[model samples]
Target: MKYFRVDLITATPNPQRCIYVGMHQDYSESFVGENRINWPDEKKAGEICVKRLLAGERGHYGPMEHVQIVFNIGWFPHSVMQQARTHRIGVSFDVQSMRYTGNRINQVAKGLLDIEEVFYLRPIGHYVDRKGRRYNYTQTQRNIDLQYCEQAAKRYYDLIEDGFAEEHARGILPFDYRQHFIVSFTLRGLLHFLDLRSKRDAQLEIRELCRLIWPHLENWAPEFAAWYQQKRLYKARLAP
Candidate 1:
């Protein structure tokens, strides 16, 4: 059970902007998709370039501002709050703050809480029944948490309706409740972020987002993308 949805709303340099800036090497604006490059084949490209980039054996790469990408990340409230601290790549989120607009909740915009990150620890009963059974509890607890959150949110809304202060009512909302955000960054910044967040040491939630974005960018900028992949992705076998 996944607790969130991550979408690449828009990326830059836009195909038009790339054309305007003469960044397009092989395709025209009309023919080019949003990023100007299509990449079902460039998965290997990232693997090659990201390794070299992270090794400090950089051949040629400039400042991080060459390319820009924006992500619409939908996740539990706790995740968004934690992710807000990831300022290395110019990250920003549209948080549902109770103090801001009072009880005027944006019902239309708030994404539903989907259980994604945390896995449930099942009881010993299942394990004893089946030796190889690896049943996940993500969906189970999510259902539980979601029901609790909904009731809490509803109660909070009721409190506000009855003249309670927004701040006080919002206390009921759990950190795992849904929240949305927009993260943007330049190519260089993204590279740095990837080096840090895409590693095994990074948080699983953020790492997932980085993994998804890497492939999307490969087709858009093969040269730059390749370089990044060589420098960062293959950090294991490559020399330091």
Candidate 2:
């Protein structure tokens, strides 16, 4: 099985500047002279921006919509992606097409010949029993699950080999199969995503994804990160 991972790819140039531009928009009519005004220190501006946001000032969130970020997320179960796609506002996704890329297998075990490799996500807490104790699946159980997925992969490949279209052949593939994608979101949208997905009640796989992405976001915008952390509005808690 492959573990989930998230990578920060790129972000808006001078993200603080973008925030300032958005903040300026709300007060643009008040400027007496030239419309453009320069803030000497971007960090100071960011701190002020975060303060206004935390104070619940009107239109503060509008500025956050200007800052944008992109991430390369991959190797997680298709089920996790299904949950992630629910947050559709101010965000965009470019996902791998199983219909087009079904023939490509990037994972191959060392010293294993003619093996149809199938990857899955082992969720952190989904296997817990009713007593609140973690239930470790025995080797036999693991093998049984793997066998089922392997059979599905075999059927999918066989259909393709028999001249069936990939779109049709992909029907046999399991939802546990791994997939990757590039996701983009505005700062406001990302905060909303983190708020919902990082919650204790969120899906385990996606919460893990949020845990991985949070520190990177903190690094990108420390002031805003601090405000979010302090507010605790999203129930953002890491998995044990």
Clashes of 2: 0
Q: How high is the lDDT of residue 225 in model 2?
A: 81
Candidate 2 segments exceeding 4 Å error: 29-37, 56-59, 105-118, 123-136, 233-240
Error of 1 at 188 (Å): 1.2
The residue pairs in collision within model 2 are: none
lDDT per residue as tens, model 2, 52-163: 6555623357778778899999877788788888855568989888878765432222223223234673523336655677676666776677777666766776777689
lDDT of every model, 2 decimals: 0.52, 0.70
How does residue 182 of candidate 1 score in lDDT? 73
- Residue 98 miss distance in model 1 (angstroms): 4.7
Query: Mind giving the per-residue lDDT tens digits that candidate 1 earns over 109-132?
Result: 133422222211122222212344
TM-score of each: 0.57, 0.82
lDDT of 2 at 5: 80
* Model 2, C-alpha of 138: deviation from truth (Å): 3.8
lDDT of 2 at 121: 33
